[model samples]
Target: MASATFPLLPSAGRRAGLILARRTEPHACRLSPRFSTTPRPPSVPPDVAGRRAFDLRDERGEDNSRAQSMGTLLSHAGLMPHRDGNEPLSPPIELATTYERPPDGNYLLEDGRGGGRVYSRTNNNTREALERAVAEMEVWNPTRRRPKRRVGEDRLSDGSTTPPMADSDTALPPPPALPVCASFSSGMAATSAVLLSLNAPVRVVLPDDIYHGIPTALHSVFRRHGVKWTAVDMTDTDGVKEALSLSVAEVEGTDGDVVLWLETPSNPLCKVTDIRALCELADQVRCGGGSDVDGGGGGSCGVNITTVVDSTWAPPPITQPLLLGADAVLHSATKYLGGHSDVLMGMVSASSATSSGRRLGAALREVQSAAGAVPSPFDAWLVLRGLRTLDVRIRRQCSNASALAEFLSSHPGAGRVHYPGLRSHPGREIAEGQMSGGLYGGMLSFEV
Candidate 1:
């Protein structure tokens, strides 16, 4: 009844990079090995919870504090210790991105049964494995120490990292799983997928000042497709409600299935909405501002509508919409997820309520396959590679942005600078509520 163990993997956390080593033993890997030597903390602190051990760091030469947040064992130090027969998947390379079946007479596209992978897209080992993990562990019941979120990386004093997928601790629970996870060629493709699944001619409620793409796509593309749109001043619920009413009263039917686009610390402006409150309104499909409305509308009034937020702005770790009650979530992976603007990809992380969430996933995948918009395995690989450094990147970006903002604010040349980290920011209060934990984020804009 002994557990399989792994080895110590480490790197300097300058950027996210992983190191993998193979172990051939007398048992020919009869049992899983243990990799991590981090002694379990004698007693984890209440206010302080972070990953601390230096076998590896993402891209940063320092240790990754977030990666350590999940009780993640970076080293495959202990593996399949409780397996019955044996670890079924060997080569872990076969576990790479696909599998193959015997090329028998039974192999036909129409009647393909027991056939191996028809295509990598239909069945990618790495992506599927990741999807499986997402489906199983999408719930957000994070604790001080035993957090549900983990990437299991082993860091060292050098600049190499080991991913948590290398450890069993990375396999998440299943309640978060659904049948679909739609990936897109770019941010536009992902948002387009949302438009396609929703059946156009409907108005999309957006923050008056948000990402330029929404309007660009809405006008050039979506409008051509019969999709109408409106903008909301998301200062408070009531203001959003006024915008919703203006949009709704102009349209027909039982409010219809409208889409609410959320972009907190909105692009350029850095304006934010209390997602928790907004999501509550969205769930009820109501709109109106509460007394919190800045100047548009006062009193306790709010609105609700089908809610979708571009997590790309703040990213997930900084702010999580699914936990707040987002019907569907989208990410322009190109921005932060890709870390480098080089690769272009978008993702729709959906909840179970929206079938388009599922449908969009399938449809997007189909489009990607048909149009060859499918992210190259290499590109996808690179993106996954970048993800390991996300926390470090974001934190660094925040530091850089904050420093820049401070420099501008104190400058007489600067007219008005809007950054949540700055005390003068109107949305700072709301931003503080969600983006706690000593992280102000990396992208802050200034106005000259």
Candidate 2:
């Protein structure tokens, strides 16, 4: 967050190989004595030295000050200059399909995390930069340290507890890791990656009014995947509970996976689901307690149930689903994150706490790198630029949408305006509690 203004260099009759000495302070630069054979100082500024240099304090005297707001984080995107000092202010687009190997010739480091770039299909600097920006924007507060918890305590935001491990020798669970994000070529591609990544014999529960692309992909792209899904009225908590209960019974003794897919303010209908209540329900199902259709079973069925939220309609600026006890949050970056309809991209941010959530995140990354459905470097850069204006753009769009919904509700020709901000909207209270900045969002639908 320290903003510095450097003096511009003169462009008259400069040699190609000549290097300029950098100044320590603003307006304090000095030129080195010229020599024919001696090497010139580096054109870029040297790292400022001293005890204060090692401290990570920002201009505001706070550490990691950029995490304070979405606007601040996005504004500082790709601003960290390279240590070599030869990089440009703007993040240069790395279009190379492959990177040069270091002299050691090891593509992957020993720890498995420190590999130099191998191929663009797996990872690239530009894409990684965009991923970091998106992850920062989606988190509630990146700088706030999580409170330490005792072993055997539930890690979920909800009070529900995970079943204890059967083995007495089992070690205490590791601390939940921060969320991981992966970018994809298209929204459906991201969806397919998540679906296909799941182990076979899985049960998926989805809202009846979600985006049409999901159903389309299920039938066409992921038809061969061995997962069965049911469409339910997610607005009806009791109905959803019943569906989950029955699905669990059907998959009992088979060791199948159960997933609850949620989409609040569902596409085209704008019907909101109670995320907290549903998360509790999913937890109950995962722990094996639902209305006993098979006659009052006391214990859980050991099914691995996870909830995923498609928050594309309500991006990070509008709502954050991960904090609401969801295992993962998905977004169609092509929609609002880009703010303009020019780029096609998708993102998934998954929790690192639960074994299933961590597995899903890793599998999605594997599918992304192996299947080659990644966004282009230029496309990722465009989305990053769009994110810089997201905070302001969403506020204006929400205001306009609220006003328009009110106008449409009063019009005699218009039938039933479907917007959460409207007074007559069924989910008005839920939206007010869940959405950020007291705004319901820009998307609304109405019948004429």
Candidate 3:
């Protein structure tokens, strides 16, 4: 009997935008016509103790030398191995529902033999590629490779060029652990995974203008499991702080935990929340900084406070929540990430700042594997293909959205225009300071 192994990506170093596949020794399965003629790595790295499912390498060595621009990262994040030389330009879809299992009862073989990968629901090469692609986007530091803006692109009131909101000097550093993103069947499934992964008796502080699905889920399904939530104006940092303080006091002396749920450039309303400010507040509550009289009164000193941002409406290059200190960032890949409206997927990427935050990725992975709420391999491939054009698509979307918002605002029939890019927007100042390149986002709503 021959033993086989599947190596996805490396665990350490610059692991973004790399994919590898190998078959150890020869077996009857090797002759199957179902297998494509994908080139193999010249050699697979020795298996380390803590190696993970995905270990794609950026053979070009560009990922390790310098940070690439958002456009470049998106273009190559989910890069497949080359054809004959070793790496691929595009990903090959692996639609096998099940892989060969070992004759022995043990399925825990470190190598690919036996039941190492018994089911496709839990482990799929195509899906994991999508996860790695999105994870790269989430963790990429735009400050590392700031693109030079064109003339008259974003001038200030004083006729000076408006500096980028997130610059190299001011941007937050990368987290200790490499960011790990988990892909789910749908956006709601991704949201549910985050809530379920948390310790029970949880209280989620939700934004008043968030997508309706969140509140509906909390009230319908999650409430039965002791999951409670409260809605507040997230734009008002003070109001958000008050909500957290009260939530902690209410759950004091119990195993109750808190999650500050944020949806920036909120759905329908398009109101922007100060993600950095709220994340800092969550940290203060988690680390006991909010124990003073003005704070949460010591009850929140050691309480677990997780900050999650639902940036579905404002995807990357425009807003990177993890870099702004969020514990985890969620994306409804069904939208921008899958641009052509042909796929349904969701992603939740964990930040590596704190111990718990670092473990969050693995925790989400557990929930994903157990719950089996994962997207099909084909859907994952579609999203991966869509990622390559995300930067260009988003730029044009933002430009068109801004123009439409202006036209609506000027129309006498329109009552109110809701867009963070407009000066009339109340959160325009915070949005200007938080959003990169002065490009607000593609979503806007107006009252007629």
Which prediction has more favorable TM-score, 1 or 3?
A: 3
Which is the winner by TM-score between candidate 1 and candidate 2? 2
Global fold similarity of model 1 (TM-score): 0.63
Q: lDDT, candidate 2, residue 417?
A: 96
Off by over 4 Å in 1: 1-116, 129-141, 144-180, 246-256, 286-304, 353-372
User: Which runs of model 3 end up more than 4 angstroms from their true locations?
Assistant: 1-66, 81-85, 102-115, 142-176, 290-301
TM-score of each: 0.63, 0.74, 0.74
Q: Candidate 2 lDDT, tens digit per residue, 130-224? A: 88777766665534433322235333333444443232222334323567889999888888778766766777898999999998777775557
Q: Which is better, 1 or 2, measured by lDDT?
A: 2
Per-residue error at 8 for model 2, in Å?
31
Model 1: per-residue Cα lDDT over 283-344, one tens digit each: 44343323222211111233224567787777755776665656667778788777877888
Whole-model lDDT values for every prediction:
0.58, 0.74, 0.77
Q: Candidate 3 overall Cα lDDT vs. reference?
A: 0.77
lDDT of 3 by residue, 102-221 (tens): 677567786745437778888888887888778777767755534222223344334444333233343345433457789998999999999988877799899998899999999999
